[model samples]
Structure formats: structure tokens, C-alpha cells
Target: MASRKPSTDDTTHKLKEDLHHLTQTIEDLVSATADDSRSNIKELRARAEKRLKETRDRLESRGERLYDEARDSVTHQVDACDRYVHDNPWTSVGLGAAAGIVIGMLIGRR
Candidate 1:
């Protein structure tokens, strides 16, 4: 059996979930220490808040870029495939048939 690789959507979802968890944890920490009077804890909390904001912004930016890149890659592949099929219809048909046969055999084996 072939192992499936993670898709871009799956990766993006995982990243979003991780960022949400991190944000929640940091918020909890900051709120839990809200009653503290220590200067060091206050400073640390402020820093954590800043870093979390920066991280969220960075992740959003990167996710957009990744999505754009993946879209372009798939578009390019599809255009190429279309061109190939137009250029060699018979070859494409033969290849498709061979693929179907292989898949059928694989399923039969199971």
C-alpha cells in the first residue's frame, strides 16, 4: 500500500490549530499572573504577548504565500497535462488505460 503524503490544506489546518493552542496557552498564562506584582513577571508576560502577536502575523503571511505557491504549482501541472493530452490524444488514452489496468489489478490483489 502507498502511504499518502500530507496535503497543503492539512498542513495549514495543523498550523492553525497549533497557533490557536499557543495563543490560548499564552493568554491563560498572562491572565493567571494578572494578580502578580512582580516586575519580572510583568515584563515576561508583555514579551510573551508581543512574541505571540508577531508569530501569528508571520504564520498568516507565510500561509498566504504557501497557498499561492501551491495554487500556481497545481495550475502549471494541470496546464501541462492538458497540453500533453491535446498534443497526443492516443498516447494519453493508452496511458490512462494502462493506469486503470494497474489499479484494477492492485484492487483485485486485495
Candidate 2:
């Protein structure tokens, strides 16, 4: 037995085909509703709902993955800042406030 792999060009062409089909389907569904055809309206609504669910699931998973990737770096930076501030509160406060002011001014110029 042999397994088949999908290529990038094939995937691109398939995406274009899918977009055309979905557009035509939605148009047909809308026209059906305008003409008071309940069956098509129901079918299209179901398809749209399913697509939204899938899209949301994908986004949530990707967002979780992104957060996981940055979590360690963000935590380490925060911890380092905490140690610095604890060691020299006055100096850390002055430096942080100065940095914030400088950043604010730069952003304001932009």
C-alpha cells in the first residue's frame, strides 16, 4: 500500500475551487431565502454555523499555542525585573519611570 501526499499547488487550486463553490452556495442560499425556500435557507445556515465553529476552534488552539511559546520568555523577564526592583527599589523605580516616559515620547512623535 502507498500513501499519497498533497502538494502546495494542488492545495492552492483546491482552495480557489472551494472558495468559488462556497460563494455560489451562499448566493444560492440567499436567493432561496428571498424566494421563500426554507430548505435551502436551513441548509446554508447549518453550513455557515459549522464553518464558524471550526474557525473558532482553530483560532483558540493557535492562540493557546502562541501563548505557550511566549510564556517562558515573558515569565523569565518579569522575574528578572522583580529581582532587580527588590534589590534596588528606588533605582528600579526611577529607571522604569524614565524608560516609560522616553517610550511614551517616542510613540507620541510617531
Candidate 3:
């Protein structure tokens, strides 16, 4: 008996045939079970949607709380800075002018 050699074309043809057969099998299975799969997907979608909505609401409220905290912190800082500037107006004025000059120079360079 002569031994047969495996060719690339033959291998590719066999792979294509196998894939075609698998595709047909999958199509038949899906056709037979599509209703059940759709029902399950619907239930999962509803549950997932509800959970997502709840999570969104929670995150939105959390964001509001964080925004309030940030505003309070910023207001407190501005008040403290204002007090310091008022208490030491001369020093603050000198520092402010120096900072303004440096900023002006930087902007001019740009």
C-alpha cells in the first residue's frame, strides 16, 4: 500500500467541510432552542437593567454628596485665605504682586 501524503489544499478543504458541518449543527440547535434562549435573555436583561438603574441612582446621589463636600472645602479654604490676607495686608500685597509679576513673565514667554 502506498502511503498518502497530506497536502495543504487537502487540509484546508477538510477544515472547511468540518466547519460547514458544525455550522449546520449549531443552526439546528439554535432554531430548536431559540424561544427558551430568548426567554432567559429577557429575564437576565430585566434584572441587569434594574440593577444598573439602582447603581446609577446611588452613584448620582454619591456624586451630589461629594460635590457638596468639595464646595464646603473650597469655601472654607477661601475664607481662611481671606482672613490671612486681611490680617497681614501689606505682606499679602507684596506677595501677590510678586506672584503676579512671575505669572506675567511666564505668560509673556509663552
Candidate 4:
């Protein structure tokens, strides 16, 4: 048997849970007013901030990679279409005209 990979939705849900837990921890620390508790709160806050920054960096990196992938995919598709249009100009023109006529007829009926 093979292990299943976690989906993006699962990753997002885990991140949200981590953030919520961190927030609750911070809120709990806020209620502690003793001098010893102050030091503990400071350390906890620093660690929490570090974790948040790390999570943000991970999310940003994923977003950038996804954006690059989409841009490349679109560029490839557009290049393919451009080549096809150049190689078969008449066919492309005929297809465009037929599509326009269909759209015109549909609109005229409405």
C-alpha cells in the first residue's frame, strides 16, 4: 500500500488550525500579569511570530510557483495557437467567421 499525498485544501486547513491555536495561546498569555509570566509570554510571542513568518514564506513561495506555472501554460497555449493560425490562415479565418455567425444569430434571436 502507498501513502496518499495531502491536497492543497488539507494543507490550507492545517495552516488555519495552527494559526487559530497560536492566536488562542497568545490570548491566554495576555491574561497573565506576573513578572515571570511576562518573560514566558515574550518568549512564546517570539516563537509564535517566527512560526507565522515561516508559514507566510511557505505560502508565498507556493503562490509564486503556481503563478509561474499558470503563466507558462498560457504562454505555451498561445504560442501553439499563433503557430496554427499562421500556418493555416484561411482555416482560422473560416472558423472565426462561422463562430461569429453563430454568435450573431443567437444574439439576434434574444
The per-residue C-alpha lDDT of model 2 at residue 15 equals 54
By lDDT, the better pick of 2 and 4 is 4
Local distance difference test scores for all models: 0.81, 0.74, 0.70, 0.80
Residue-by-residue lDDT tens digits, candidate 2, 1-110? 89764465865675566566667666766777787777778988788666556555655765675677589789999999899889999998899899999999999998
Those runs of model 2 whose alpha carbons end farther than 4 Å from true positions after fitting are 1-31, 76-110
Better of 1 and 4 by lDDT: 1
Per-residue CA lDDT of candidate 4, range 7-95, in tens? 77987897787678667666756655344677887877776677778767877876786788789999999999999999999999999
Report the Cα lDDT for residue 30, model 4. 66
Q: Compared with the true structure, what per-residue lDDT tens digits does model 3 show for residues 1-110?
A: 99885465865685566556555555555564566687765655555556556555655765676688789999999999999998999999999999999999999998
Best-fitting candidate, measured by TM-score? Answer: 4
Q: Which stretches of candidate 1 lie over 4 Å from their true place?
A: 1-40
Query: What digit string (tens of lDDT, one per residue) describes model 1 on residues 34-64?
Result: 6676875676677667767777787787778
The 10 consecutive residues of candidate 1 with the worst lDDT sum are 28-37
Clashing pairs in 4: none
Ranking by TM-score: 4, 1, 3, 2
Candidate 3 local lDDT, residue 49: 56
Model 3 clash pairs? none
Candidate 4, position 56, lDDT: 77
Q: What is candidate 4's CA lDDT for residue 88?
A: 100
